[model samples]
Target chain A: MADIQLERVRKMFGKVLAVADVSLHIKEGEFMVLLGPSGCGKTTLLRCLAGLERVDGGQVIIGGDDVTDHPPGKRGIGMVFQSYAVFPHMTVFDNIAFGLQMQRVSSAEIQRRVGEGAELLQIQQLLARYPAQLSGGQRQRVAVARAIVMRPRVLLMDEPLSNLDALLRLQMRGELKRLHHEVRSTTVYVTHDQVEALSLGDRIAVMKDGTIVQLDIPDRVYDLPATRFVGSFIGSPPMNFLEGTIRSSNGARALETAGVRLEFHGVPARGRDAVLIGIRPEHIAVERVAVAGGIPAGAIPAAVVVVEPIGPQKLLTVQVGPSTLKVTTPVDFAVDQGQRVWLRFDPSRIRLMDPQTGDAIAS
Target chain B: MTVAEQRLEQTLPPVRRQAVDWLPYVLLLPTVVFLAVFFVYPMLQAFVLSFRSPEGAITLRYFQAMLKDTYFAGALRNSFLLTAIIIPLQVVLALVIALLINTRFQGHPWFLFICAIPLGISDLGAGLIWSSFFTERGYLNLILQNLGLINEPITFLSFERPAWLYGAIVATEVWRATAIVMVILVAGLQLIPKDYFETADVFGASSWRKLRYVTLPLLRPALQTALIIRTILAFQLFATVIVMAGRIVPVLAGEAYFQYGLLRNVNIASAYAVLIMTLSMTITIFYLWLLRTKEEELGRG
Candidate 1:
């Protein structure tokens, strides 16, 4: 296995920059996920790493070699495409054996390795079947088997699970994680689905407009996003942003927005008049009745606008004055639309973001 | 199916089975009538004319006479030789042209347009155009002499050089017909998804390997079609051979034309027509057998 280093790799399609000057170093045997929405250059970056797209500027060093000018075949990488791309003309056995055949491996060795890979993927029974006879999930497994059988230095996957149905995708995702744990090969997976990224990647690099905005472990990416965009893009129901003005009085700093005032601590909102308070849906606790004291110290009274049941949890869209906020509650919680509730924000979990630049304010 | 649906189906009569069957036949009636009057009738008449004696008794006199003719063996040999040389050469050239166009480089549309120009020209027109260059004291000789490659002008279509006459006819046929095959192959290439090539590249396949293992295998149906069409057309090669070589290269179709037009013998001409038709059908069957697609092979298995 080999680590990959991309140094200021830039690619352009006409005048539009598909991949900007993005530099990232993936450790040997680490599974790195390039996560972003469509047109965000994550796929382009993966293509550059695969040597499929030539970088207009900078270097791509794999292992210890500066292989910036190498063709895809010579780069020692195996890629699983988004469409699975299992060669329809060949049987599953041939598809898995293609790379080995291209490498001119010995017949006996090819057979042994193909058998090992098929057994690993649980596709031994499908060796004689063509791609037309395989279902989408089966095709995906065949594609994975095809790539991993090569035993390449780097394995690149471009949204390989996007085409499968939800249940199949989940099952395949677990199988992929188990496979990676067993093989420990350096893999670069590109996908727009955050759930896949969060579950599969050792480190998720959130990209936007051809440049990576944040690179960190999944937990860090979820707990503390680097920017407002990252914070909003990562969580389900997303993070609720409330426009509030920072007020400093008598050595205590507090954020006052609408008629609700929540005091903040350890938040350095220096030189900013207003800040965007970001809070995840699950972090806020809602009280149906007023507390003994009018409201808790950091509680904001709000009326629920909509209640959506999501399996075991209830997502309540509560309006705090003119601004709307999504609050996650237990499914058994008795709360309805038009019901007034007091929202208690976990003070430590509150994030302050810069409205001007969409950057998260340092706490 | 659900029990209710099965019960409904059992309770109801099959819907309009006769009318649906009769509708398709009624729609096909015009085409069947047209073929009967224009194709089957003439084919039967020709078969009768070729075999029957003048006294209304069945005889093989016309076939025996045609076989005994001095030019018949030479014509048959020339026809087989020309077809064997032309079909393979045209297919290879057409595949190359189709692949070049598939690259989609700048001005490829214009390149395809230029390559297809000969397709618009009739076989006779192409023959005439090339014959002008192959003639004695023609542009070919002039250019050779001007370049000092030859001191004397060559008579390319001379009867003494049957090989030269054969070469000229082969060149004319190749130029006139390769475009149609290229068009068919190009359409077939487009139907193949680009992902296969990309996957091949990722798997470390070289350009030649990609062509052999992927492009060619996937292109079987189109290749089968092109070979059959080109082979059938090669057997019927007439106007171009007549235009380029005249009597110097005696092909089967040329013999038929000579027998019917110059000698005023319709029976011998009918024999030649039947021979040409048999040859075309036989070659078509051979191609169909040789290039059976993977699906067809699998189905047979």
Candidate 2:
């Protein structure tokens, strides 16, 4: 296993710059994921690291060696493509053994490695089957087996689970985590799914427009996103952003939007003007009774527009005024649509961003 | 009259359902009729004529005559020999050229246009062009004489050596047909996802190994299609061979034409045509079976 570092890497396709001046250092045996929306150049960056694409101007240093000009075969990196690109003509056994065979390993050794890889992937029974005969998930496993059989210094996965069904994707996600733990190989996985990035990555790099906006542990990225874009993109039922102007009211700073005024206890001095306030749905709490001291210190009164019961939790789409906010509450609360409720917003969970720049306002 | 009309309307099916059910057949009727008259009728006529005798007696005399004739035997042997040499050579050459064209190179369209030129040219035109160089007072003999390689012009297409005549015809035919195979193979090469090759590279596969393990295996369907089509066309090899070798080496088709047009023997000519058709069909079916077996093996792999 090896640590990979990209120094000021850039990729240009004709006049369009796909990846621009990006620098990242992935530590040894770390599972670093590049995550973003489509056309964000995350996959392009992964391809550049795999040597499938040449960087316009940069050095790719792997395990202390500068491999900028090296071909993919010499880079000691195995890759599983999004399409599962398993050779349609070869059996699963031959597919897994392809790398070893290319290395001119003995027949017995090839059989051993392929057998081991198939067993590791739990696809031992599918050894004689071609890719066309395998289901989507099975084909993906074979693709992974083919990559891992080589035992390269690093494993690069380009959205390998994207082709599988929902249930299979979830199962494969767990399998991938387990595989990473067992192998402890330095892996660079690329995906646009923020959920996968959050759940699977040791370090998640949130990217936008060919640039890395934030790179941190999953929880850190979710809890304290560096930018507004990172805050909005990394969460499920994503963080809501409200346009408001920060104002000082009675020795306290507050944000006033079109139909509501929310007092901010810890308002950043830099966001004294127009700012975007972000709050995750899970942070807001709903209660049936307005008990004395029931609402949090900084809370707002709102009317629930719609209540969607999602098994264990109730997702309440609440409207403070013209603006709508989603609040997740326990299912036992029994809140109905059009019911009045007090929303308790945790000031600690509030994220402030510069309206123009979309950067986090320093507190 | 009004009561009778109402009864008739009740007996008729729904207009929408009838249109939906009959529309497809109505659209297909013209094409079916066209094929029946143009293809099936002519084929049946050829088959019936092949069995008739010169004196209008039902006899196997023409078939027996074909089996015994030295000229017929030579034509069959020459056709097979030319097919065996030309088809494989053309396929391999086309594959290489297709690979070269498939690369991300400048002037790719121009190269493709140039390659497709021979495909647009008629076989007879191609043969005539090549014959100019092979003639005694042609460019090849002139160059050889100037280089002092030979004292006199060598007759490359005359009856002196029928093998050279047949060889020249095969070469010209290959030149005319290779472009088609190249176009098909090029499209097949494009269907292969780039990631497959990248994966191979990641495994440190050598160029030869990649070609053997990745390229050739993926090219099976295209190769099969090319082979069947080329084989069928090779059986009908007429204008090019006739233009190059004339009567010295008559392929089956040319001989069939000769028997009908020169000898005025319709029975023998029809028999030859039937034999050619049967041979083409058998070869096509044999190749299709081989392809099916390969597909089954692939499926079971």
Among the numbered candidates, top DockQ falls to 2
Residue B188 error for model 2, in Å?
2.1
Q: Which portions of model 1 miss their true places by more than 4 Å?
A: A290-297, B1-66, B296-301
Question: What are the candidates' individual DockQ scores?
Answer: 0.42, 0.52
List TM-score per model, in order.
0.91, 0.91
Task: List the pairs of residues colliding in candidate 2.
Answer: A130-B301
Candidate number achieving the greatest lDDT relative to the actual structure: 1
- Candidate 2: residue B289 lDDT (0-100): 79
Across residues B14-51, which tens digit of lDDT does each residue of candidate 1 receive? 78745355788899999999999998998888899899
lDDT of 2 by residue, A236-348 (tens): 77887777777776766776665456655667654357888888999877665555555544456788898888998888888876578887988788777888787766778
DockQ of 2: 0.52
**Tens-place lDDT digits, model 1, residues A1-363:** 999999999999999999999999999999999999899999999988888888999899999888899988888999999988887778999999999998899999999999999999999999988888788999999999999999989999999999999999999999999999998999999999999999999999999999999999999999898999998889898888888887777876777776577756756747687888888988899986645556565678889999999998999998987789999999999888899888887878888888999898887
- Report the TM-score of candidate 1, chain B only: 0.89
The deviation in Å at residue B286 for candidate 2 is: 3.1
TM-score, predicted candidate 2 vs. hidden true structure: 0.91
lDDT of 1 at B276: 88
lDDT of 1 at B93: 97
